[model samples]
Target: MGEVDIFKIMKEAEKRKKIKEKPILVKKVEIKEILPCLTTPGYIRFTAQADREIADVIPIIFLMFPPGKTNYSVKENTLTLRAFNRMITFFPNGKIAVTNTRDKQEAEEILQKIIDIINEAYRSYLKYGKPSKETIEAAAKLSWMDIYNSLPKTNCGECGYQTCSAFAVSLLQGETKLSKCKPLKGEYFKNLERLKQKIGEIMLNTLGWE
Candidate 1:
């Protein structure tokens, strides 16, 4: 019998379901303000508003990624993170501020991505119960530790990183590709397989990738 390609199976199932998925989205978003962002010097900030409040989904959406290099405030219902080389801040009242973007079109595109993510989280919340405070906190504790442990650990610079630890950090941040680590092709090939499953080839393929 031929072996089952689990990743392919899962991807197909998700694609089939995605066709029927209908998510409630903010009706309209208008960019009402444009301000200079000191962070990127020449770059600017895009301030926009959604049609409805997104307070409930803010925390749920934040769970989409690890807490590394991100800031969140429960009281204020806000999240700040990096994506598309821009700094994005999500507010509970459906306000969005994207910084470090020089063009209006790019800002609008980024806003759409954020809306897609928000809708994704809303769907998850509908299917599964809201994530607990404990679950959110635990996910934050997931640092470069597990990812670092899964590396070749040879401190090789072949991956354009000074050390394997650096490469692991980049991997967690989705800054670099898994194929960049050369040693994994050698005796540490097992590490490659392990990393693939850990990182979830199927999950990443289906998720809203930044």
Candidate 2:
């Protein structure tokens, strides 16, 4: 099979496992207040919630303005926010979704915490706007082939792999450790650390990390 096929298989297996898992219950929630902002050409409103502990487990929710023009859909924990220019998909821990334009005011009054985060991200965007492609590419290129080649070519089982190529694939997927190569000790190990930092930067800047 091709490398892409292998990656697809791994991703499918992971998705299935995630799907089988149940989400924790979020209860006794209250929402209040709404602040308006723009998600793109369309405007958005901040909604707040009270009496819930859904933080950290889910993505922040926002109520889009001119509501029916944008749609928010949820399947299990995954939430997709669709707008004219952009589509954002995330898993939300809170029991909140963007309401249709007709219910805009009511939805805003009920989900207070959601309102807070939307406002924050909006303010950040106004100040910094979107991150540049050059910045993102710089982060992606942080890791070099030289560091990858320096790894022990042996497919030693000590790293819990039958082959070095397998380990390299894992590294690219953020699944395996460079130290597991065993032969890459000292300065070589340090270089691996640097490469990881770069990879992490890329993942963050590009929103590629899950």
Candidate 3:
């Protein structure tokens, strides 16, 4: 008999678990805005408003994040965080702003995720005051200009992008890699490596890594 497909079985089981899990019902939430992402064409800026007052939770969100991984202004009561491809900003007035989301479903999923994180942050704050500031630096947000500036700028079609700026946007979206740029060599290649490292650090921080 062929070996049992344990990996496939586990994946199926996980899928079933997801199906069984109840969806988060964000009450009175509406998409307030949708705009094109400035860094990446076709990506979107999505904003939503919720019925509940979340101002009290902004501090908790700040307390949960490691210092350099997020941008929080206590005076303003706002917390800005990056999660995956989305840039999330929490406002004091129960409104949330999200950027770089691909579609409505993704925006909704990110909203649910932000709610869960905020709740967790509140609980942690109740117990631990605030997370200690760490020296391990991370990017709070990525910019296309940063990527574009680091790229070879040869505008070669080797990466299947028409322009270097297009490739940079794709890099920010995780659609392409520096190694794919045929013209990138020597100092330009080193710059790509550095950009890649920066991106990796940002990705890890987004996952709540300290």
The candidate scoring highest on lDDT is: 1
Compared to the true structure, candidate 3 yields what TM-score? Answer: 0.48
Q: Relative to the true structure, how large is the alpha-carbon lDDT of every model?
A: 0.70, 0.43, 0.65
For candidate 2, report its TM-score.
0.29
- Predicted model with the maximum TM-score: 1
Q: What tens digits encode model 1's per-residue C-alpha lDDT throughout 1-210?
A: 999999999999999898557776565677879988878787789899988888887777666654454677765769987767777888888888888887788788877787777787777777655766655554445467776776788887898999888877776676775567767668887865664454443222222222
**Stretches of candidate 3 above 4 Å error?**
1-28, 125-210
Q: What is candidate 3's lDDT per residue for 152-199, written digit by digit as tens?
A: 777878778899998777665545655677666555667755754664
Comparing 2 and 3 on lDDT, the stronger one: 3
Q: Write the per-residue lDDT of candidate 2 for residues 1-210, one digit (tens) a residue.
A: 545688889999999987455332332444444434444334454333434443332222322221222232322434445432334333344444343322455444433434444444344444444434443333334342433454656565777878666655565444554546565664456555554454333233222222
Q: What's the C-alpha lDDT at position 80 in model 1? A: 88
Better lDDT candidate (1, 3): 1
Off by over 4 Å in 2: 1-135, 138-147, 185-187, 193-210
List, in order, the clash count of every candidate structure. Answer: 0, 13, 0
